[model samples]
Target: MALITRGFGGRRRDDPNLPPGQYRTDDFPVLSAGPTPRISLDDWELAVVTESGERSTWSWAEFTALPADEPTVDIHCVTHWSKFGTRWRGVSLDTLLADVETAAEYVVAHSYGGYTTNIPLEDLLDGQAWVAYEFDGEPLVPAHGGPARLLVPHLYFWKSAKWLRALELRLDDEPGFWETAGYHNYGDPWREQRYQAD
Candidate 1:
């Protein structure tokens, strides 16, 4: 499968954050399903759309200008590698959506190049998720979802869609590109939800 690229990072087996069937990697890896989209800051904008089609927008400057939080968390990829102690700086998804209201129970995170992923709206709240722009104190790189990306570390990395643009709230769950193709709908790393049994 084009999506499965495994790298063993020689991490300790005792690390509790390392999910089952995962190895620790100190170095970040670059994996993408499509060509890297170069979104100039001038043209970059993040939109939030409710199930009823209500939309709220945040431009590049406006997004970065918000009060930022630095989250230290571990990142796990479905490919079997996990990065521990990964630090990021960005506005919490809660902070971004504070002024917006939605009755939706789920979310479809859409990105450039038509990449999308499904995430539970509840999983994104209460400081669990962020629209991260900087990683390790550097502006995110395109290959690694630079400029901006959704950070949902509780799930597989793919759910944290790269090159993120809009988040569409939904009352029902729908599979995104990878999920529909083969990956699990709700990717919990600890449970090893890489693919649902066929």
Candidate 2:
């Protein structure tokens, strides 16, 4: 795993497709609030747990050694900018799921910054989702979610949890941090489920 760092800042680049500004949560087309979740764990929490409770942990080197594939796909942010032809690398979600035993109907993804998002098991198990370690053919920078991030291309970018830590299989659809706050439960980007349509 890449060493965790703070003070990572983002720069705005002129993308003909997006408005000119420092892109951030405020720039988000949809905004809402919710209670952030927290967890206290030791280094032993570093293991990946399969549905059947099989556990496997990886060091920085081992995690990076997993087979990687590049995906060139358009990325749509809930903040309203769509970056096209973005490339990412990491193990395919399907490949990772195959190693686990699960009867789950949903998934609750946990992140480092006490953020969580609930996604249907079907969505996560789909071949398109990935545990992305690289972006644009390079190791993903921290601000953009380095080490590993969850990529759910079909949903708004917030659904793509960054600084991912664990995947908790659930038997029910539990709203995550944003969902509980006001973001749509199923953030379908095409449907414009960016915020609660009040």
Candidate 3:
């Protein structure tokens, strides 16, 4: 098990009143991209390529059998509205990173529906990030990025890329779906990179 720091700041359970379930700021615009995309994966279809170009693919059953742990964390979106104390379950990113060797400096997290996000490899291997397959003690729902999702608590929620499918380690920085459309390349929540600035 990887040791993670308890808190880093953003949202807290004691914060002002907010409804349960995931909540984002008006700035995010509800992502009107229509219904969520689905990409089925059997045990043989799951793959992970390390920055060093090593590859490991797992079947659905194999992945599901891996050790999973629950973590309660706060989520902050670049748009606004911090959600606190959300529970998630999945293997820690550190565990996954340990299995692969990477010399890349960054990662492009790809998803179905062509959505993707660029994140630094250092941020992902730092041990706080996770591949969350469950939320609130239950299997994640489709609208909320079911099956699996990336959770990077420190950065803006966009960096948490939902409907997560693959992690492509890159030797250099590359903008992703939203980043290409004017979102900030780094997307720090405290910096508030909700939209493109003049």
Candidate 4:
């Protein structure tokens, strides 16, 4: 649901296409908490670890072999920028978590460079999220979360952790790097849930 905030003003407004306090931008802005980490495809792997300690992993080749989907979604950042019609090719989170057994309701998406973001498990299942390896028809560049990144377009972009490596299932909802630092625990863009207070 798109929201309307009467007094909010900043970026270019596209009321029908953006969340409450966002403006449309054609350029994909790069925002990272730290230096981008360089990772080689040969060493790239995605692991799904359950709360019971069981683990499942997929190498680069194995991961790419799974079914892929091309999704064109509009992404909203907490910083107030919204990019529409962004195209991506990726393996759905459903495919990644299919064979794994878990009753956990939360997950912590871990990245190669120590970045982590907590997300509700429900938000990742079905067709809600992806482990995207391509952006705009090309292999994702490091500055934009190369190799692969979690694509949860429904939420704030930060929940879509870049350089995604592992998903750790949790019985409890734990605050990740940004969540602990003041970002909302569940970043629903339409709600303008950028910070915890929202």
Q: Which candidate is the best by TM-score?
A: 4
Which consecutive 10 residues in model 1 have the weakest lDDT in total?
4-13
Candidate with the larger TM-score of 1 and 2: 1
Which runs in model 1 stand beyond 4 Å of their true positions? 1-12
TM-score of 3: 0.78
lDDT tens readout by residue for model 4, 159-182? 999999999999999999999999
| Each prediction's TM-score versus the true structure | 0.92, 0.73, 0.78, 0.93
* Cα RMSDs, all models: 5.5, 10.7, 9.5, 4.9
Model 2 residue 116 distance off true place after TM-score fit, in angstroms: 0.5
For all candidates, what are the clash counts? 1, 1, 3, 0
lDDT of each: 0.91, 0.69, 0.72, 0.94
* Residue 56 shift from truth in candidate 1, angstroms: 0.4
lDDT of 3 by residue, 1-198 (tens): 987765533353334433233353433234424578665654224456766677776566777788877888777765456667778998777877676766788889887667889988888876678888888778876677767888998777788877777888879998998888988888666555666682
Quickly count the clashes in candidate 4.
0
Tell me the lDDT of candidate 2: 0.69
Instruction: Please list the residue runs of candidate 3 whose C-alpha ends up more than 4 Å from where it truly belongs after superposition.
Output: 1-32, 40-45, 51-53, 196-198
| lDDT computed for candidate 4 | 0.94
Query: How displaced is residue 32 in candidate 4, in Å?
Result: 0.7
